[model samples]
Target: MKILLIEDDLDLGNGVRIALADHGFDVVWVRQQEDALRQLDTGACELVLLDLGLPDGDGMRILVRLRHERQNLPVIILSARDALEDRLRGLDGGADDYLVKPFVLAELLSRVKALARRSYGFDGDMLEVRGLTLHVPTRRVMIGERTVELTASEYALLKLLMVRADRVVTRRLLEDEALPGAHENASNALDVHMGNLRRKIGEGFVRTVRGVGYVVDTAAPYKVGE
Candidate 1:
């Protein structure tokens, strides 16, 4: 799962990022509210860990704007404000969960897992389209009897495409969510990973829309003969 972390605390952010990554989560950490809002626009993150305090703007504003825009997106407010009113406002403002700062990482992870399970839906965290099965908790992808081992980038890309199955996911959105900061590496980095993904999972599942982007067709056959 990909999580967007909007936090300004250097030490805490780093710790959270490392912890999430260690547990097989793709995390995009941004300190500034502007950057966080930009990332949110990309629709890359499945969950958000929003800090109520930010350097550029109030985190509440971001949360408010997010609720206005993406109503169903899961948001967990990580704030030092533990007052009843603050928690009430956060929940009333569409945040799925809230965690007070100086809390244990284990607790945070627990909340994240619980939210992911509830929000992502059914089959115990499995996302299935045709014969492709992506196990969210384990970060495992399988086709028929074969287990496909994917790199972090590959897995991220596949998850995004699958989550938005049958919908055209633009190239820019894919990069922002899956590749993160990989745009600087190579112009065709997305293509390379995508090509590998198609080969591993077999053909006809992911289709290119020429100048547009890619889509995972739920009705497409598992594998088309060469």
Candidate 2:
């Protein structure tokens, strides 16, 4: 998952960034609201951790602007304001979750996971497509009684495809999700990964769209070629 953290406190920001990164999340930290807005414009972040106080402007204003522009992007308020009215205002202004200052990192991480699951329309950490099961939090894949081990990159790629199962996921989207902050490689690299993934998961699990990209056919049973 990719997260944009808009925080001004160097110590707190670094700590949060490190913790989230350790949990397999790509985090981009920006101390200023302008930088946060710029990152949003790139359409790279899956979630936003916004502080109510920013160097350039109020963080709430950024949240309002984001909702005004892209209403679907999940925004979680991370601020020191613990007042009831403050929490109410944040939610009313389109913040998905509110975290008061001096919160535990575990709680913050949990909230992030919850928000991500909600955004993806997942009922829990486990993602089910046909008979294949992917445990998002544990990064485990189960095909019937057999367990499949996957590298981080492979897991990332599979997760992206599985989340958007039955829909065509373009190579550009997969590349962005798999490798954030890196130059895009040729399509052949993705093809190689997909090839390996299909072999491990089962042949015909992921269908290629020729010139388009790939899609996980959740409605179809896994079938090896004739």
Candidate 3:
């Protein structure tokens, strides 16, 4: 989904952006509070990763306005602020989740997924079909009797397919959700990722729909010749 990332540090911002992009999020990053406000006011972003410090003003000003205007918007504070009061202030100020600086990229991605899933009435940290399992909190995937490793992008793609099992996930939706905004424009990117995913998980795991999209049919039988 599209995320509004408001971090001012060049190093930190770029790191977060690349990491989130690898995990299949569309990140619209801004360094100043005003720019963040403009993006938020447009109401196009699905989530917010905010930093308390900004060039124009404290990010709290934007957070305050956000709480006032969009009470349901999901905001996660990614900040260097670790004081108890600071954490309390952010949570009390309408932040949905908070992560301190020097955190792991996987944890942040998991939190974003958990919050996004919860918004859609999914309550657990896991999704399972047959013997294939995905532990959302840990970003772990397991087959019936073995564990499988997936790259960040692969995991995102698999999650999208599994969660929407029993239906065809259109190419447009997959491209928008799993690919980085820039890379999604590339013609061969999706095919490459899908190929890698199928190779790792076995071709039986996901079914292609020719021109329509892909499907993870929970009840689909393993083809004899596949």
Candidate 4:
């Protein structure tokens, strides 16, 4: 998952970024609301962890602007304000969830997962592409009864693909999801990860669309190979 963290506190922002990255999420941390708005324009972030107080401007304004433009993007207010009116205003202004300061990282993670599930209608941590199963929480892949172990990058790539199964996911999209708000290392980096994933899963599991991008062949038959 890719997240945009809008927090002015340098230490908190860095800590959240590192923690989320360690938990297999691509996070882009911005200290100011303006930068957060700019990053949102790229349409790469799946979620936003926004602070109500920002250096440049009020984060509520950013939230309002985002809802005015794209109402479906999930935004969770992460701030110190615990007043009932503040929480009410945030929700009324289009925030998906609210988290106060000194919150547990685990709770924040759970909220992100909940938002993803609500957005995609995924019932559990396991993402299903036809018969292939990817357990997101465990980073485990199951092709029938046999299990395939994938590296962290490979797991991340596969999860992204499965979330949008049968859709052509561009290299740019993959790269953005891998490293949010940063320039991609190379054009072939996605290909390398995809190749590694395919080798572990199966040859025909993923398909290349020539100059377009790649797609997971959700209809292909897969079995546990001994």
Record all residue pairs in model 3 with backbone atoms less than 3 Å apart, i.e. clashing.
Answer: none
Error of 2 at 89 (Å): 2.4
Clashing pairs in 1: none
Question: Model 3, residue 82: displacement in angstroms?
Answer: 0.8
Q: On residues 77-178, what C-alpha lDDT tens digit does candidate 2 reach at each position?
A: 999999999999999999999999998998998888788777754433667777788876688899987899988888988887776667677777777778
Candidate 1: residue 101 Cα off by (Å): 2.5
Highest-scoring model, TM-score = 2
lDDT of 4 by residue, 141-201 (tens): 8999889988777887888777766667777777776644333444566767788788888
Mind giving the per-residue lDDT tens digits that candidate 3 earns over 1-226? 5679999999989988998777656689999988998888766576899999788898888889989998877899998999999999999999999899979987888888888676532223666776788876678898877899999889989888876666677777777767867244668778888999988888677889999889987775766798
Q: Write the per-residue lDDT of candidate 1 for residues 9-88, one digit (tens) a residue.
A: 99999999998877667789999999998998877778899999899988999989988998878899999999999999
Clash totals, every prediction: 0, 0, 0, 0
TM-score per candidate, in order? 0.73, 0.75, 0.55, 0.70
Point out where model 3 deviates above 4 Å.
Answer: 121-226
Q: What is the model-wide C-alpha lDDT for candidate 1? A: 0.86
Give the lDDT of residue 144 in candidate 1: 79
Could you give the candidate ranking by TM-score, starting with the highest?
A: 2, 1, 4, 3
Worst 10 residues of 3 by lDDT: 118-127
Listing every candidate in turn, what is its Cα RMSD in Å to the true structure after a full C-alpha superposition?
4.8, 4.3, 8.2, 5.4
